[model samples]
Target: MHATVSDHRSDVAVLHLRGELDADTAGQLSAALAGLLERPVPRIVVDLTGLKFCDSVGLSAFITSKQVISARGGWLSFAGANPFLAQLMETVGLSRYFAIFPEVDDAIAAAQI
Candidate 1:
């Protein structure tokens, strides 16, 4: 997968992901997200519009990320997840740990608050 990290604002960061997120690419994504946690409270929105597939390892990465971010007093959210991914998240219980938004704008708006 290709992960691009951008600073949305002073307090928010946006991560745009493309392709597939699996064991081979999970480390790349994890490294990308690690850089955004320099601040005191990191608010991140992961844009998954271009993501095609996410394996269990990839899902585990997200769950682990949520734990780390939360422990650091920050928030990690998801945006633009396709219907299948949405259902997968629900099926695997990721929906409980993450606040999924319909789009990047919605997640950004909510994060800003």
Candidate 2:
């Protein structure tokens, strides 16, 4: 998987991820998220439209990222998850822990709210 991060605003960081997010790529995601936390941004939005697959490791990375953000009194959300990935998250009872959106704009708006 590949990850790119952009600062949309002073308090929000947008991360665009592409390819598969399995065990091999989960570490990259974790590192990216950790770098984001080092910044002054208070919120994070992960765009997953380009993501084709995700595994348990990927899910763990997401959970870890959320925990990091929450510890800083911030929030982390995901956008553009495909049906398969979405189902996986639901089946794992992680849907409630994350704010999922069908569009990046919606995710950004939700994060700001």
Candidate 3:
């Protein structure tokens, strides 16, 4: 998987992810996200439109990130996860734990809030 992190605004950062998010790539994502969380950014929007697949490890990464950000008084959200990933999130009962948006604009708006 390929992940790029960009500053969306003053307090919002966007992480654009492409390709599969599995065990191997999940670690990379985690490390990158850890760096983001360590910063002062208050919100992070993960754009998963280009993501092709995700495994349990990826789900763990998302959940862990959410917890860490929440503890830091920030938020972690997802955008454009596609239908399959959406279903998977629901199946795993993680839909309620995250703010999933249909578009990057919506996610950005939420992040700014």
Best by lDDT: 1
Model 3 poorest 10 in a row by lDDT: 34-43
lDDT of 1 by residue, 1-113 (tens): 99998888788889999999999999988888878766678789999999999999998878888877888899999999998899999899888889999999999999757
Write candidate 3's Cα lDDT for 1-113 as tens digits. Answer: 99999887788888999999999898889887978989763589899999999999999988888887888898888899899999998899888888889998899987545
Model 2 misplacement above 4 A? none
Query: Between candidates 1 and 2, which one is better according to TM-score?
Result: 1
TM-score to true structure, per model = 0.94, 0.93, 0.94
lDDT of 2 by residue, 1-113 (tens): 99999877678888999999998888899888888887653588899899999999999888877887788788888889899988988899888998889988898877655
lDDT ranking of the models: 1, 3, 2
Model 3 bad stretches (over 4 Å): none
Q: What is the lDDT of candidate 1?
A: 0.89
Model 1 residue 67 CA deviation in Å:
1.2
RMSD of candidate 2 to true structure, Å: 1.2
Question: Model 1 — which ten-residue stretch has the worst lDDT?
Answer: 33-42
lDDT of each: 0.89, 0.86, 0.88
Residue-level error in angstroms, candidate 2, position 57: 0.6
